[model samples]
Target: QKEVEQDPGPLSVPEGAIVSLNCTYSNSAFQYFMWYRQYSRKGPELLMYTYSSGNKEDGRFTAQVDKSSKYISLFIRDSQPSDSATYLCALELSGGGADGLTFGKGTHLIIQP
Candidate 1:
């Protein structure tokens, strides 16, 4: 199985609704988790990052990690049309050589007016 697994959701919601996305991993050695937002044909922009087991919040975005369950989540509040994009979950293993982060197949999200 892949180290990280996320539903490639074509998730749709009305503007102003709260959106929740999730990912799960099998590697216990993964200590760093990140959520990235990507616009079509554009590079991903980091939205949130967390280390180990804890919660991190920024503006309308929040990230959570649970080492015990090897699960992670991202919550987006007050969804807007501008927030329509692909969301990707990434993991960095503690001693992961130069291989860099392993990313999930991105979930596509759309906020409608």
Candidate 2:
């Protein structure tokens, strides 16, 4: 199994739908969970960062991590076309520092106008 994996979802939804994106990791040593938003050819911007298990909410986005299950998730409420972007889930290496990131394939999300 891959260290980290996510479905590359082209999940299309109406303007006001709630969206959910997810990822799973095989390494329990992973401590940092992050979500990134990428628009087309542009590089991804960090969306969520959390250590261990918990839920963090920012604006219309909510991020959840379950260390026990080695899973992570992002939820978007009241979605908009402007929110359309690819979501990537990642895990920071256990020891950290310059080891680079392990990223999922990313999910393409489209919010209809």
The models' CA-based lDDT, in order, is: 0.91, 0.91
The digit string of per-residue lDDT tens for model 2 on 1-113 reads 88988999789999999999999999888888899999988999998888879999999999999999989999999999999999999888764575688999999999999
The residue-by-residue lDDT of candidate 1 on 1-113, one tens digit each, is: 98789999899999999999999998888888999999999999999978868889999998988899999999999999999999999888754455598999989999999
* Residue runs of model 1 more than 4 Å from their true location after superposition: 95-99
Provide TM-scores for the models: 0.94, 0.94
TM-score of structure candidate 2: 0.94
Checking candidate 1 for backbone clashes, the offending pairs are: none
Most accurate candidate by TM-score: 2
| Candidate 2 lDDT for residue 35 | 93
Clashes of 1: 0
Q: What's the C-alpha lDDT at position 98 in model 2?
A: 59
